[model samples]
Target chain A: MERLPAFELKRPTSLAQAIEWLAATPEARAIAGGTDLVPNLRDGIGAPPVLVDLSRVPGFDAYEIRTAGARIGAGVTLARLASDAGVAAALPAVSAAAASIAGPGHRSVATVGGNLCVDTRCVYYNQSEWWRKSNGYCLKHLGDTCHVAPTGTRCHAAYQGDLAPALIACGASVELAGPRGTRTIALEDLYRDDGLAHLALEPGELVVAVAVPAQPRGAMSAYRKARARGAIDFPLAGVAVRLAVDDGRIAAIDVALTGTNSRPFRLAGTAAWVGRAVDDGLLAELGKAVQKQVSPMRTTVTQSNWRRQVASVEAQRLVRDLAKVAS
Target chain B: MAKRVLSFVVNGRLREEAVGDSTLLLDLLREQLGLTGTKRGCDGGECGACTVIVDGRPQLSCLTLAARCDGAHVETVEALAAGGRMSALQAAFHEKLGTQCGFCTPGMIMAAEALLRGNPAPDEATIREALGGNLCRCTGYVKIIEAVQAAAAAGGGR
Candidate 1:
């Protein structure tokens, strides 16, 4: 049976103490839910000397939905968010994204922050310790060579997080606490293009909470993903769309995608097409833009080309479906 | 690693023990406490074989640290029967031929037990959603779903 390596666990009473513990131990990693980190630890992927348990941290469990928007705590469980009617009514995309993660058991313990900070995964990198050792590892871990690209210097592991794209599409921002202080950044800016150093957080910085600003009136959003199975599988490709139509024309639209590249990004071409009519030609053009922008590599077991095409199609379908529902 | 005094209730019995920081709840249940009913299929969160009810929620015991469940009420498969008689869900599984090899039965039952407690009259779709994390090699899930439905029909879900 696989086992976790030895490490000291510290349960801090406050966010400040958690930050202190992290700063004190450079190898320490904050654990909100062990849903993701624990498995990686068993695979011998990362060996942090200390695990700061954030469950005891006060003020990190709040889940509020207001007219302005929502303030979701880092410690809010995915199950709770998925089951909440208010979250479903207000931010259906976020709720659906939460509901679509792993399964019921995983959702019970998995947290909002953990899903947002889920590690970039690859077929080569997510193997067992024995398998990784036999393969001599890869550029993402102890090894020097990149098996995916062979000659590439950087790790091409894909960031397959489900929550980020939905949150980013809804114009969310993250509140971060660190040894330095507290600050907020647009959720899209929280990530970088590098899979190895994907999160733009500094050492000892922790994602304290996520703040989602209110959407425009009469807007609707939803998220969808394609995977190998009906459940318990990571997304091969996922898309989230927020659309507000005024007089049967696009008044506002935001689209974001995951499982394509090293970072979940807002589609950069949406702003120019805001006022265009939602038609078959416009949807075809949107699909082409998606296919052109997304760069999926050999990260998942699914074919990269298939994933890219699926992303484009899913994006177009979501836009058309949401527009139909609104009209 | 620092050892902390842990206290929790298991199957309506309270126990206290010193646990290392890294001691998983699965190990504590199977090794230290001698409750081997919770099978460790993947030893990771991928498989639902090591599932148990922690604080009325079905959670992957292998993914949970024993220290994290300090004051929680935990229920395992051993608590299902009373007076050596199989509970309604267990009997439904036994009579409905839900167990082909029986390795994944305990976890499946525990997950169903949690679901029944929350939603006594779950439909077929709800049953599938609740057991989504559990993988069955045999019976093709038809009998398992039938077993859960039968148990709910017998008033055991309450």
Candidate 2:
């Protein structure tokens, strides 16, 4: 067992206190559900001087269902998000994504905010300190060159989050709180394409909650994740689809993918379906379009070609599934 | 660094201990309190060997900060069974020959306990998904799933 190094732990009962504690130490990090961060700490990936435990913070664990939308607290565990009747009924895609992450033990404690801000992983970067030192570490850490691409200088670690793609597909926004104040930004804007500096959050800013607008009638969403194992492995290629067709024409359609790039974002060519009627051929074409867009490197669980193929298959299946709900 | 006292209820008993910053819940339970039934398979959260029920939810004790457990209730595998007799779930595992090496038994039972508490009757797919994080290399999952099924059939989880 890899032991976590020595550090100071602070449990903050209030959000204000948590923010104050985080701002107090520039090296301090807020941990809602330590599923991701704790393991990273034990892996010697980071050694923060102070760890502000946000698990006890009140009022950040509720899933508030408003008239038009819902506010999902960042502290809400993935298990709760996946199993909550309101969350499942309101946004099944979100529930599906949450459910697909890791397994029961992890989901029960891993929070939505943790999933949103989960670290970008790579084959060369996620190993133990000793393993990386022997493997001639990548640009993600002390080394300069990327093992995946010898010529590449930047870290192309794939973003391994399950919920971010689904949330982005649903046009969700997040409430960010910091020492200065609070502000809400579109979820898509929170991510930068770079794997190293993945989040756009300023220093001391923390994600408070995610706001998901209510899905209109006739709107349906779904998610598909391809992985090597049934349980704990991260997805090789994940595709989340959202679609709504009024009468016979497409009202809206958004597709987002993760584990295929450095950041999860809305899939391109979705505007081609704004007013179009989706046919089986068009669905296959959409799959092909998505396949062409993906250029997976040798950084994930599955092989590069297999990842591309799985992406195409999942995209097509996702569209076919969503089409069933819409029609 | 600062040390804080963690006061939490364990198996219906109030317990208190002072812990440092990076003291894991596993360390608190096994080292501070000498509750070693919870195995440490992977100090990383990948393996479900260190799972303990915290406030009616199953969480990996290895990654849980002991200081964060303030004012909470935790249940370990030792809480099950009375006297020397095994609990129904434990007996079901024994009867079904669920353990080949017995390494994953405690964590598996704890996880199943949480599952059965919430859902007394989970189907095969549900049971499989629920225990997916728990890896067993010896007997495989056929007998383990069968044990859970047998427990559910005997109305054991509730």
| Top candidate when judged by TM-score against the true structure | 1
Q: Write the per-residue lDDT of candidate 2 for residues A296-319, one digit (tens) a residue.
A: 788875698898888888988887
**Candidate 2 local lDDT, residue A252:** 86
Taking the tens digit of each residue's C-alpha lDDT, what string does model 2 give over B1-158? 56887789998899888888788899999998899999989778877989899999888899888888889999999998778888878989999999889988889999999989888889999898889999888888899999999998888663
For residues A88-133, write the lDDT of model 1, one tens digit per residue: 9889999999999998889998999999999999999998999999
Model 1: how large is the Cα RMSD against the reference? 1.0
> RMSD, model 2, all Cα superposed?
1.6
* Chain A TM-score compared with the true chain A, each model in order: 0.99, 0.96
Positional deviation of B110 in candidate 1, in angstroms? Answer: 0.6
User: What fraction of the true interface does each of the listed models get right, in terms of native contacts kept?
Assistant: 0.80, 0.90
Clashing residue pairs found in predicted model 1: none
- Give the B-chain TM-score of model 1: 0.98
Count clashing residue pairs per candidate: 0, 0
What CA RMSD would you report for each candidate? 1.0, 1.6
lDDT, model 1, position A253? 96
